[model samples]
Target: MDEIVTFGGRVTLGQDRQADDTERFLEMVGDRVRAARNRRSISRKTLSEISGVSQRYLAQLESGTGNISILLLRRVAEALDHKIEWLVGEEDPYTSDAVAMMSLYRQATGEQRMRVLEILDPDNPHLRRSRRLAFIGLRGAGKSTIGRLAADRLKLPFLELNEEIEQASGMPVNEVIALYGQEGYRRLEKQSVERIAATYDSIVLAVAGGIVSEPETFNYLLRHYHTIWLKARPEEHMGRVRAQGDERPMAGNPAAMDELRNILMSREALYARAEAQIDTSGRGLPETLDAVLDLIEKRGFLRA
Candidate 1:
């Protein structure tokens, strides 16, 4: 008979539960290792050689009796060309398409991975937005200038989303913002995106920098059109806008540059979700335009 000790009537039970949970987790890890090896048609001896873990240890591991160290498990995972988390994850790697897709996505080239993402996106299911390219960035990334140039060179229609919104509302963007408020403006923005998707199959589009702040609308844009993020330093962004005679960004705000940098930092991850990116910092307008065009052509962004 074994003596059980309890502290406050809970310790013994808690210990039992924790032990059982740990045993189950170890069994799961063992099962995954065995399954992965079997799927690859690798023998225990061969796995041992590849992973540098002894055959006896591999046997014990597969039998759920070996409490392998994390470093050793990592080596085995690498030998199997699988992520360690896949083996230890709650989802069964053998059955989960998500795990498989993640593995494939990790192994895929940038272009192929983007295609996989596009196909898997649940947001928009109608075929690819044919021959449509969108340039997205902050105010001074040269979206309008580069976008128009690329469109003309590619012989496609060029449309700026803000202009479309103004045309649709029959008012300037400032008036729309002033009268309807930010939320109202966002509603109009979403509608304009839908209209453009329906209207054009071959066009270069430029959109407001803040579009990425709205997840649904941004996801829709990503689903429909091939997107490119144009990047620039905060100073360059302010300088370019000022060069265009729009002093609103720095007119009275002493901290405008800091705010701009903060905005870029915060939205950096969201902007990176684009399929392609172009950094225009320190580049001449023509050089940036050529780079964007080259990327589009190289990536076959407009190909149906």
Candidate 2:
């Protein structure tokens, strides 16, 4: 004797449940296929011509009455410029925006992918109004000088990121670097930024010049702060470093100028991703400050 199942006092057979599940699956597949076709503005006749599937078969598929083989479904998916998994509801529905994002993601390198993920991450802090403004650029690009002055004028707190890192580790940055190496420094850098982002609502941050080299940390900063790239000519960078009484720019490395140029060249693209930029070359501190203030005003970054 076959056992019968009762739901709500109604007897149900196992075959009945299997049949219902199959029907639901078919309906879901049909709905997704129709949606994908409509989103592309593709007609069944056009799809049939491209995919070599019959118009009648496509119509049946959309109506949830036809069974489709994997081979035929692949052909239809290719014609609609969608993945098979997307058409079959195995993945999220494909919108034009999602399609474009996926295409860009596929083409991005690992570091670039980290930056992209920051933008796409749902929990990104900067998705809301960011309270911090970060200045990014090579050393001697006026990030410290201009960022501090901007913070004063804006009546916000100013923080140098390296100092923050040192404080967090209870050691100077150079010592931290010497003990932990570059990878360890980057890990600490990320932790420090996370802490600062959580603690401050409105602040000005001066970041290290090589921060961009660590994509994960840099991406987090991009998402949590209003970033501005402080730009300067290579000669100006060296001269300004020297002016600050820091001979480290030329100390121990005779090819320091060439090295500086190479570093700038490599980081130009990453820095350009900042929300805004100010060229500090040939500009006085007051003039540069005014430029940054003007940008802030224009962007409505400061909350009333």
Candidate 3:
């Protein structure tokens, strides 16, 4: 009884663990497959049609008798938009909200998750953010210049998120993106935000315009910082970039201006979510700086 004897009468190490548990494993797989299908509202016949597996075989598999092949199981998993590991793993996906919540969260858009967070945690944002302020807008919105000037005048610490990213990464922002790709860079950026939130209580921060395109990061900024949208006309944006000698925006692309306009139009709503806005469309450096400082003071953004 201690040793397992095969057909050739060759005894092997105790019982084959997998062999002895085959029935349990098969039952578990069947239960998972059925639960996944039911959760997705797909009948066995429909799943069979989608998975290209025979209905009889699927019925046997679900009844916990058929030893389904890996390839066929993979097909069923794909048909259910699930991973093969999830189907075969010991953990019951439906037993815990954490697993189900993560799946739902991963499938949801950034705006949807943001709204859900707002509903789930309706704490006072002003108090949560403390005295931190963030300036968000396109590249030429004068965020760095105005933010620095305002921070100097207000005697508050000023930090550029890109600079922080570069410092933490030991490389430039472009190099970080090149080395880690956009998704990796985004992860690093989120980490930087968390670090800043935990580090300094009062500071002026400038962030990239594309930050709004990322819903979760933007939502974090909204919750933890007094955000200001520094907007400018499309032409002004281009001109300012050109003035800074950064011809990258319109270097060789003839439709660069149009592209810039399209980007602005697309992100307008996201940027508009800021607590306040300042249009530096036609304003000079001094005027824009004054406007930003005035808005911050008038809005009492730094009030604790």
lDDT of 2 by residue, 30-121 (tens): 88888888888988899999999999999989988888999999998899887887766544645557766777888888657656756778
Per-candidate clash tally: 0, 0, 0
Scanning candidate 3 in windows of ten residues, the lowest lDDT window is 10-19
TM-score of each predicted structure versus truth: 0.60, 0.59, 0.60
lDDT per residue for candidate 3 within 162-264, as digits (tens), equals 9999999999999999999999889888889878988987899999889998889999999999999999999999998899999998878999999999999
Better of 1 and 3 by lDDT: 1
Candidate 3 residues lying further than 4 Å off, grouped into runs, are 1-122
- The lDDT values for all models are 0.90, 0.86, 0.89
- Candidate 2 TM-score, true structure as reference: 0.59
Which regions in candidate 1 have their CA more than 4 angstroms from the true location?
1-126
lDDT, ranked from best to worst: 1, 3, 2
